[model samples]
Target: MGERMFPLERQKKILELLMIKKVLKLTELTEELNISIDTLRRDLNHLTKQGKIEKIYGGVKLVESKFGESTIADRLISHIEEKERIAKKCSEYIHDGDCIYLDSGSTTFQIAKYIKNKKNLTVITNSVPIVNELMNDDVELIIIGGKVRQNEQSVVAYEYLFNFNELNILKAFIGASGITIEKGISDYNLEEAITRKNMIELSKEVYVAADSTKFDKDVTIGIAPLDKIDYIITDGNIKKDFINKFKKITTSLIISE
Candidate 1:
């Protein structure tokens, strides 16, 4: 038989479960984890001591999560269905004659794939993948000039910052590594964070599209707070607690089917 999961892996799963259910009883956790009560007790005790969870009457709840940035391939593969749902929901906001900015995110790239047929739509992006998908489409594509950040399949630089001032964008669709009520929007890269802040300033409206997995999490760099977002489109499977929290932060909270 294969080796069993490590304590660290089990603890991570516990935190992820908390993010989904908001709360879980010890019994449910034992069943899901396939571990005995005594072993799970050790894991829970460790996580609680780390300040990662709050031990309630019968189970545990997640404190906010701190996540590291993943490679583009990792991000694209982890939650494909949820990302697609969020993308489809965000795509409904696109219209002909509108100039929009698409952040270089896998989810935002999905939006590009969905909107290929929209004639006269101006798409400004720094993402290599997004540009490759839309260059031959009916939409107007503007690729920002910057050093390519190959891991993200995007570019980041300040040399072309003035270009944004010359154009009027109707909307900006931003993606983030983590989003918390306290942190608003954030990512792991300093340069990417700078670019997102500029996009926020240049656009008349901002829409953030992220999956449920991104909720209640914070990363290394801060982008902006709730006040900057006009709308947030996410998958419907998100926890009710997250839904309520996001609703209070953004002007409109759309749950995608």
Candidate 2:
């Protein structure tokens, strides 16, 4: 037999514990909440069903819904203002006739918006939308050929890497799932990670464009090591301690207001 849902106070307390400790095992939650193990399980099950948390083996963890999926539509809404701020900052790096590589991302797409009117620069990318964004501009648009990954709205395949190897990209603007002292940079998708990694290697300057929410959260796929990143452009809400920690790894950290 199953169990009934706990009172709202119990649910609030569960969320509190998750925020404080980051993760809680079934037994741990039950003991801390002074509830039966079965009741705790039911609460966890309910929370998971609501998308408030995720079940990981013997434990549960708070998973921000923004990090829940890497779809283009999901990303388009997750950090709209922060992306705009970062995109504005990226424009200062652009100059006429400068060759550039824009990594496929919702944030990078915003960068594309700001760069559309510029002339005499080469824009190379695997992003479908970016190609369309600059197609009418005088700026030369180079679309790297590969299999389309529709969810991210980008291309990535062995063939794409082969094509990427043949070109020398000048600058790269990439995205990340998380930046950490321990785990370095990572992404939610393995294919996106590979594409970002290759872009980083091919470029002279690599800028990671992420929002405040991306800080301190480690996802599964490793994109690149922290030392390899030249700039991290995120919104101002990133914790000072985390930013200070990043200072040890990166020389330039641009926290947009």
Candidate 3:
């Protein structure tokens, strides 16, 4: 027979349960694992140290979770300052007259806010809000036509691909469902991944704008490999160890303060 697991394995099991479900009370973990209260506390501490979950009054929940099926408004509040800081840093990379593609995500939307005053820039995107943000600006906006995804406030369909195919973009600011050295880049939906992949292929440089929470979570579709990425712009709360891991995978990693 195989060797029995230690307390750490038991704690990992608890986390697995939390990931698949929504929330779990301390009593549930202790009762199911048959562990003492003190041992359970130690397990929770271990997982917390690893940035797996947050400890609550009687239970633990995933640290980077959309709790209680949180709406987009709720998520926008979670990392507002960090995203604005990242937007400022990304703004430094854009120059006058650059042809850029902006992807649909909270962080990238913040970048759109920063680009409003910019002049003579050409923006190509399938994000409805982004197109509207630049509509009255001195810049030229080429909105890729596609079927709209209302929840995401963006479009992802074959017509969008047709728009992308004919254009030569200077840079692409996009997001991923997950970023890992192993899987590279992934998205939760296949249709979204298709549009993202086309943008990556069309752009000379691809910059991924993600908050710290998007670091380890794996979604369902594969978009691109690490070899295709030029930079990653994220927040300060990301552990130094994880940032270093990505540095070894890509050349430049900009982590905002």
User: Could you report the Cα RMSD, in angstroms, for every candidate shown?
Assistant: 12.3, 13.8, 15.5
Give Cα distance to truth, residue 87, candidate 3, Å: 1.4
Name the best candidate (by TM-score): 1
Please rank every candidate by TM-score, starting with the best.
Answer: 1, 2, 3
lDDT of 3 by residue, 50-150 (tens): 98788888888877645433433334445788888987788888888899988877677778878877778898887766766667788788877778886
Predictions in order: lDDT? 0.82, 0.78, 0.77
Where in model 2 is the C-alpha error above 4 Å?
Answer: 1-68
Better of 1 and 3 by TM-score: 1
Best by lDDT: 1
Local lDDT at 63 for model 1: 63
By summed lDDT, the worst window of 10 consecutive residues in model 2 runs over: 1-10
Error of 3 at 184 (Å): 1.3
lDDT of 2 by residue, 125-187 (tens): 888768766778888888777789875778885653466777777789887878877776898
Model 3's TM-score against the true structure: 0.69
Query: For model 3, what is the error of residue 98's alpha carbon versus the real structure, in angstroms, after optimal superposition?
Result: 0.3
**Which runs in model 3 stand beyond 4 Å of their true positions?**
1-74, 159-161
lDDT of 3: 0.77
Compute each candidate's TM-score over C-alphas.
Answer: 0.71, 0.70, 0.69
Per-residue lDDT of model 1, residues 1-257, tens digit only? 00189898888778656643567999999989898899899999999899878888987876643455665644655688899889998989998788999998878878987898787899999887787678788888888887888668788957545466886989999998788888788888999888899999989999999987788889788999978888888897778987677655545778899
Q: After superposition, how far is residue 82 of candidate 1 from its true place, in Å?
A: 0.8
C-alpha-based local distance difference test score of model 2: 0.78
